[model samples]
Structure formats: C-alpha cells, structure tokens
Target: MSSPAPFSRYEFMIAWRYLRARRAEGGVSVMTWISLIGIALGVMALIATLAVRAGFRAEFVDTILGANAHTTVYMAPQRVENEFTDDVYVVPGRIQDYDAMAAKLAELPGVERTTPIVRGQVMATANDSSNVAEIFGVSLDALKAMPRIVDPQTSQGSVEDFDKGVAIGAGIQRELNLNIGDKIKLIAPEGAKTPVGTTPRVKSYEVVYVFSAGRYDIDRTRIYMPLAEAQDYFNRENVADEIEVFVTDPEKVDDWTLPLLEAAGDGAQVWNWRDASGSFLSALDMEDDVMFVILSVLVLIASMNITSGLIMLVKNKGGDIGILRTMGLTEGAVLRVFFLCGAFTGIIGTIAGVILGVLLALNVDGIMAALNALTNGGAWQPEVRGIYRLPAELRAWDIFRAIGLSLALSFIVTIFPARRAARMNPVEALRYE
Candidate 1:
C-alpha cells in the first residue's frame, strides 16, 4: 500500500478532535484558553508600545523642523588687532551683508530657503501679566512661509498683518491675556548708549497673530516680528545675527554642511538642527531598541504557556497515541497532528492581537481625550511631554514584527511536546493503559 501524504485529511481531523476534547476526557482545554489569551494580550501590548514610540519620535522631529531652521549660518567671531601695539580685541560677531549672504546660501544644492534673522530675549507684559519671551525677527515673506506658524489649520489671525505687529504663540497669549490688537510691552535690558550707561529699551507692539507650534515650550516663549523691526529692537541695523537655512531634508542636513560652508564664505559658521537635538534623538532611538527587546521577552514568556499546554495535552492523550501507533500511524504523522493543534492557537491569537492593537493605535488620541476628561483634566501634560496630545502611529513593520515574533515563538515552543508524543513507544503506552 502507498504511504499516506504528510498532514492528510485524517491527520487534521484527528488534531481537531483532540483540540475539541472535553475536560472530563482528560483534555487541556483550560490551559489552551489561558495560553491563547496570554499570547494575544502580550502581542497587543507590544504593538501598542511600538506605535506610541514611533509617533512620539515623528512628532518631535516634525515640530523641530517645521517651526525652526534645519541649519543656521552665523557670523564667526572676529578679532581686531591694533596696528601700533601687540594687542588684539575680540568683538561680537554680526553678518553685515546678510541679504547677499542669504541669496548666496539659497543657491546651494538641497537649500530650499534662507532667511536673515535677529534674535533677542525680552520680558513681555500685557494685561498685568508678564513672561520672558524669545523674539525672532524675520522678513514678512519668510514669516508667511514658516510651516507651523503660517499653517491655517493650527494658527489664527492673518500673516498679512504681520508687518503691522508681532506674531505671538498661543501660550504667550494665554499667559499675558493677550489678543489680536492688544499691546504687549517688551523690555530689553540692553538699550541705547548713554552717559550713565546702557538703559533698558522699553517698547510696546500690537499682537496681530497667534500661533501654536504643538509644543508647549515653543508656544509659551516664542514671538515673531518684522525683520526690520527686530533689527532695530535688537540694535542690529542692516545686519543679521544669523541666517536660518531650510533644506529639503533636515535628516540629511549634515550632508550639506560642506557645501553650505563654502557658499557662506569666510567669517561664517554653520549649526544644524541635529547639533542642538542629536543627543535627544539618540536617547529616543536607544529607548526604542530597549523597549522592543523588553516587550519581545514578554512575548516569549507568553509563548511558554503554549509549551505547558501542549505538554499536558500530550500526557493526557498517551493512551490514544498508543492505539494510533499500533494502528499503523507513523511518528511524523503524530507529530504533525499535535503541532497543528498548537499552531492553530498561535495563529488565532496573533490575528486577534493584531486587530485589537491596530484599533487601539488608531484611536489613541480619542482614548486619551476621554481619559483626561474622566480625570478632570491634567492627565496629559503638554508642558512636560512637549506635545499637546498623546500620539500613536501604527507602522506596518511594527505590526508585522509583533505577529512574526509571537507565531515564531509559538511554533518553536510546540516542538518539544510534539516530539515527545511522536517518540512514545506503543507497547509501553498500551501496557500502562
């Protein structure tokens, strides 16, 4: 007679029958249920954690690149030597021909836009409230082109009125109780030279626009004014403290450093966004890797329940195994049958986990909002976490990785118990029975 093919219809039927066996019949149905649930929960947790990590990283990088420059070119410090004496004096650096320099830098490959800016720190007060603010002086065109500030979706007021007044962050507006057309007084410590000393420069400007960068710190402290106005306020007339450079890809900003330097010519230095935030990004990456490993271990532990369930099933079915062996079933067929039982549980559990995890990730924002409401607010602190909301972004790779890891672990753990059942001796098993 011809030998039966591997995993034939009879083999599947027997596996199904064994899987459906009752507790009164010495089956491990209870253990099977526990193992399946454990694996499902484990996979779900892993996928959710990965989704949050990815979302946070993406949001952070987007806020940085959207609201700030990818790279900045600053005037290098200059040393002036006295021709009559062996003395040298270091003076504050300033870019005199910023317009020409900005035009030159804009022509470099990968350069998208360049803007000359004057930056200063001042105390701003309005409606009897005060807060320290960082001011950026940029041209009307550059201010209008800014990503987060100019985005109509997140920002309010008009960019056309930017030249008439200053654009303030939402946090600043809230703290100072400011609104469009409100006058905010700016107090600068450094002012015009006088016989006594440099006096504080005090000026008040109307707030024409309000914006939210989706970051608490930025929204709380940043202010934008017309470039000419900023230059005068900061005591930088016809010159810029730095030229902000926007590139096509901020991630690849380092690659353009050399060309940017050459185009900027002498008396200039370059600082990229990575230079300011590289350590933070590195910490994020390291945390992602560590979290993945820790969650994978949890998955592996969950799969251990599968091993225990299959072992119990093998022990309970020994008598039936003896009869099947004596009836001419091959060891490989027995192994395949038992393996199918464990594999089925894993496949089902993984599918359930993927479904539940994807759903949670997609609705994380709504869930967070509900949670915050239940707790009477303060559930999520944007001031501490940097973003206004909890974010979860489901990536295909993260989902696939969770599924693959769970299933692989399930199949591996099932091997030992299946092997034991396949290797059982028919004579010893029948005698015991």
Candidate 2:
C-alpha cells in the first residue's frame, strides 16, 4: 500500500480488517465479542464496589465527627467515697475557670470552636417507653456555635421555649414516640445521698426540637439541654467535665494534640476523636481494601476470556498467516496484528465500563431509592437495615488503578498466543489447505 507509512501501519490495517470480517471468512467474531463483554462487565463491577465503599466510609466519618469534637480536654479521674454511705465512685475532675479555658483553647492554631460539655448517664421516659440515654448540657451560646446541633428551621422557637425544654435526637424521638412540645422525664441516677438511701434526681423537660446527626448511636442516646439546667440537674456548678475543641483540619489531629494540651495549661489531658473511634474506622478501611482485591479477581477471570479469543483467532487464521509470512511480513509484525486485536477489546471495554460506572456512582442514591420502590415495603429498604441509601463515591485514582490493571492484564495475556501465531511455520500452516 504505497510502501506502508511506518510504525507497523500494515499490521494495524490487517488487524482492523480481520476484526470487521464475518465468521464465514474464518474470523472469530463471536469469541471476540464475548471476550469484550466479559471485560466490560468485570470493570463495571469493580468500579461500583469501590465507589460504594468509599462513599460509606466518608458519610460515616462525617456523621461521627459532626456529633462529637475533633479533640476533647478531660481532667484525670478522682475516686471518692460517699461520706455517709458505702458508695465509692470515681468522679472526673472538672475544668475550673472554663471561660478562661475555652478562650485559651480558641487561641490555638487550627482551632475552629470550643465548647464546654457536661455529660452524665440518665434514663428518659415518655409515652410509657423508657430508655437509658446520655445527657449533654451545653450553653445556648455554645449550642449555636456548633452547626450540627441545631436546625435553624426547626429551632426557631422563642428563647422561653428553649429555656425549659431540651433537644432530642431523631432516634430518641422514634424510640419514645416523642414530638416537639411533648414532655419527657429525665431521671439521673447520680443524685445526692439521703437518710432514706441514695435517691435519684428527676426532672421534667419539654422536647423543643429533634436533631439528626446521621449516626444511629448518637441519635438514639444523646440529648441536649441548657447548660444551666443540666448543671442544676447533675448538681454541678461553675464547672464542666470537658472542653470540646473543634479544629479546622481534623486530619492533623495527631499533630494538634500536644500543642492543644500545653495551651490549655497543666492538668488538662487532650484526646482526639480518632482515639475513641480508631478501631471502627480502621475496620471500615480494611473492608474497603478487601473488597477491591476481591473484585479484582473478576477482572482476572475476564482476562482469561481475552486469552481464549486470541488463541481461537490464531487457529482460524492459520492459512492467512502463512500467506502473510510468505509475503515478507516479519514475525514481530504478525505478533503485533494479533496483539492489537486483544488489546482493542481490553482498552475499549475498560473505557466503556468506566464511563458507565461513573454515571452510576454519581446517581447511586437515587438508584437505591428507585430500587426500594420497585421491591415494595420490606424488600430493599435501606432504612430497615439502618441506612437511608447506598452511598457511592468514585475517586480518580481508584478509576485509574482499575483501568490500568485491566489494560495491563489484557496486554500481558495476548503475548503467548500472539507469539505462537507468529512462530507458525509457513509451510506447515499452508500444507493442510
């Protein structure tokens, strides 16, 4: 063809012609198509699984960090026995001069917000349903500072409304059948000891609003009330159990730990969110990695299809290969022709699969909702399993890794079969015909 332009154009043209040929022309069209489909399906499954895992971990981390703090300063626990009874208990040392402590914490670099919290175990009863809960007593100013604790649309009631009421979590509301403005009883077991024995302190509070932190445990067990009221109920005054410090960069919490403790002065011990939830996060990460490896096996299986197709293709084209070899086509060129056939399937299939996967990842939530609808009430309800929808997040690196692996496998699997076709003795190949 006018002395072939170079870069193995002659081989490429032959490969293209072979791809377009009919089965009656000794072309392995059916096997080629099957191999392409297998590759595509394998790639799609990998992308979807990885994206879903990434999204799940992201949402869970956000929910947990939003409800808690990046770092918390708690005093050392002090054990003390009741002077009048046999009750010996360990009470956490409270932060003194909390206003100064919060101010000091806010001055630290990377600190976003600081709030004092009073936490204690309590039992909540409403509509004849009782559940043990953790109570968080926060100042109104502090509550407003934390964006996750309040919903402006729902918490737009008068100051008087919140003065005597409390905010419960969505899970708590569902568990107790509670509604806004409804009354609930809070029973604190750590009350004063009396002549009649250690008695529990009880108080009535109205539900002002419900906050959903997107975490089941926080929503189920946490309730927030005015700092003054909680202090009154918990029998603590001018003191807080800890100072919660929010940072601008939570990923660098480890770096911020020592500096924050030093800034808060001696006797202040600092711990980051990771310290409390590290194992849980690590488990999720490990599961995500395991899923990637597991799904990659699918691609490996698909690559076998490429090998099979190329071998069949080589077998069917023996006569044509002999003719090319007689016409002075080098063994390398012959190898390239077959390699292109297999490579084309892998590259095209991977690209198509990536595009389809990205589209699915972007709209996975909607897809889950639609699926649940089709399945009817209990069939595919994510809520029944404790999540609203299946989350999906596709990262560029993850996509690249998947595509690279597929193409690499495709290229590698083509080598042996292509070499075999290249080495076919011209006389042997044509002698049968």
Candidate 3:
C-alpha cells in the first residue's frame, strides 16, 4: 500500500527540489527546449495580439470620443418611434429643451461634457484633387476643445467660428493645395427631388483652419463646418443627428446609457461607443478570438513533445523505479516523484516563456524600429491594428492566465507516464538486467 504525501508547503518544496536536482535528466531535454520555445511563441503572440487589439480599440474610441461625446441621443427611426426598444439604430432629430437636456444630463451622476453634432456627407474638389468627405457641424462654444485633438499650431480658427467658418483636414489641405482662406464647394443631396426636377443646390464655404487629427481617414476625409452654415446648407435647421454627452468615467458607458435612455423616456434613442462602433468592435473581438485559438493550437502541439519526453523518461528509469519501490518508497510517492520529474519540464518551460513574452511586449517597438532601420525605412509601419506602436501590453490578469494555462497543460502531459511508473511491479522491472 502507498501513503499519500501531505499536501503541505514542505511536501511541495521537496517535490520541487527532487525534480530540480536531476533537471538535466528530468528538467532539461531537447523536447523541453521545443516545449519552452513553443510556449514562448504562443504567449508572445497572445500578448502582442491583445495589445494591438487594445490599441486599435483605444484609437478608434479616441477618434470618435474626441470629435464627439460619450453618448449620443437621436430620434428613433420612423419604423419604431412609437414602440420603445433599447436597440441603438435610430433616426435624427434635434432634442427638445436643448439647453435643458444638457443642464439636466450634467446634473446626473458621472456626466461630463455635453454637446450636439449635425452630420452629413459632402464631396470636396479643388483644381487638381477631388474626394468625398464627412462634415460635422457643432456649436461654436465647443471650439475650445480643438487643442484636445489637434496641434494648436495647425489651425487658427476656434469652434466659435464654426458658425462663421470651417476647418478642413490636413490631408484635404495637402491633396487640394488648400490654405486657411481657400473656399470649398460642398456637393450634397440638398433636398428631395420633385416632379419639376432635382432641387437646384450647391453650398460653398471658406476654410478657416486646416486641422490634423492624426488619422489618415479623418485627415483626408473630414471637415468641420459651422452648425448654422451647415443647417442652412442642408435646409434642415429643425433637426440634429445626435446630442453628445461625456461621462466622468468611460468604463461606465453602458451603465449610463441605460439610465440616460430611461430618463429621456420614449422621445429618443441612446447610443454608447459600442453602439456607435458595433461592427468595428465586433471585428476586433473576432480577431482576438481567432488569435487565441490559433496560438493555443501551437501550445497544444508543443505539449505533444512533453508527452513523448515523459514516456521516454519512464522507460529509461525502470530500474530506478523498481529499486525505489523495493525500498521504503510507496507507489504513491514513487508516482509523485516521476510526475514531478515530468512536470519540471513544464514548470521551467513556463518560466522561460513568461520571461520572453514580457520582454517582447515591453520592447516590441524598439525591435520593430531596429528592423525598420535595417530595411532603411522603406515603407514599413507597425501593424496599425490601432496604436502607432506595435504594442504588447500585459496586465497581471494576462500574466496569470498565461502561467495557469501553461502549467495546467504541463501537468496534464505528465499523467499517463506517471501512472505507468506507479503501476510497475518491482520484480518484473528489475529482471530486465
């Protein structure tokens, strides 16, 4: 009969030391090397991929957040105006008590900035360049926020001029050879077509500032114009696309969304960042999910090497196992000894993997920069999954997960061979000599 070792700190330390001693035999092998490298690759892939996802998500959120507010309120789509629903898709309308909406929302718990936006698409053209662009009209008072998004030197106009002038993106300026004083002609569907013909319409405005927001799409395709001018241009001064509000904390977005919607009652629909970016966020999530599964497969494949190595160890240690069984060692203790030996591969491999992954995450930017220098800066940019730096941001949570999964996988690989060693008969095992 075999006695079970007490599940104590001393017992675990004994297990650790015994396995570490013969580490050359138990802890180190070609297979162990393969396992460690495989694990490191997987963990590094995970950290880098997750970091990219976070960065991309952050950039996208910032793009929307800086230009707009945290939540947007809109008129429910005509299809379901009377029936209430929490779904975010809705039509445009100017809110009632416009100032009252802001004042009341500001009073709510955790609310920050409140603004409104009127959005439309317009086509821009210059002597040599022509492109479609997005236009946003905001209150003049919000112009104070320009520095939050753009370099202060890039544009001279403030949101105050939004009613009197407009701002063009830097890319638009570059493409069209435009300056602060250049005028742009906006071509949009001005009004519904009548039996007479399409309503004759073309609106033009002078560019007041050329602002750069650091995103290619925005820099190339967005223009901020005055609200009254846009309202006059679109002939829909009666409505706004959405009311923008900022919160004290971005993490409570969903929480505030529901209560704000509830407070607004059935008059409008509410949307958070996820609602504004639903498809984009979903695509990001799917990418993360795909990466995890794919990388986990690599780790699983590496585990096969651990399994084979353990089986070999059991075979090679038969005489040792037999002699130990003939002594005071019980089968249970013998099994633990072999199991620890096999498990040592996983433990050491995991430690190596964690170290390597952290180093990669922390210094990935330098590595990419070095690669770029080697290539002489020829059209190389870090993957723009979101942030400028190819990031591998790891939190304690991620570290814990990586370590847990790796160790668990290592322990699992030890079971079969360990059982075989435990079940061996001493006489038969020794007769092989």
Q: TM-scores for all candidates?
A: 0.96, 0.92, 0.77
* Model 3, position 236: C-alpha lDDT score: 58
Give the per-residue lDDT of model 3 (tens digit) for 1-433.
Answer: 5455544354456455544436557543555566667766766666665665565566666666665567777766553344465455444455645556666666778887677667888788876678888878776666456443455755555544555578888778888888766787778866546898767456677887777665566777888877666666776565566677788776568889777876666767887876767798789889877877777777677766777766766676778778878976677776677677657777777787777777776777688778778987642442233223344456777678767877887788778877888899999989985
- Top-lDDT structure, candidate number: 1
Please give the lDDT score at residue 47 for candidate 1: 93
The C-alpha lDDT values of all candidates are 0.90, 0.82, 0.69
Per-residue C-alpha lDDT of model 1 across residues 4-106, encoded as one tens digit per residue = 9998999989988888868585448888888888888889989999999999999998899889999999978889999999699997789989899999999
| Clashing pairs in model 2, backbone N/Cα/C closer than 3 A | none
Q: Compare candidates 1 and 2 on TM-score and give the better one.
A: 1
Worst 10 residues of 2 by lDDT: 151-160
Clashing pairs in 3: 56-386, 143-159, 162-226
Model 2, span 301-355: residue lDDT tens: 8888888888888888899999999998878788889889888889888988888
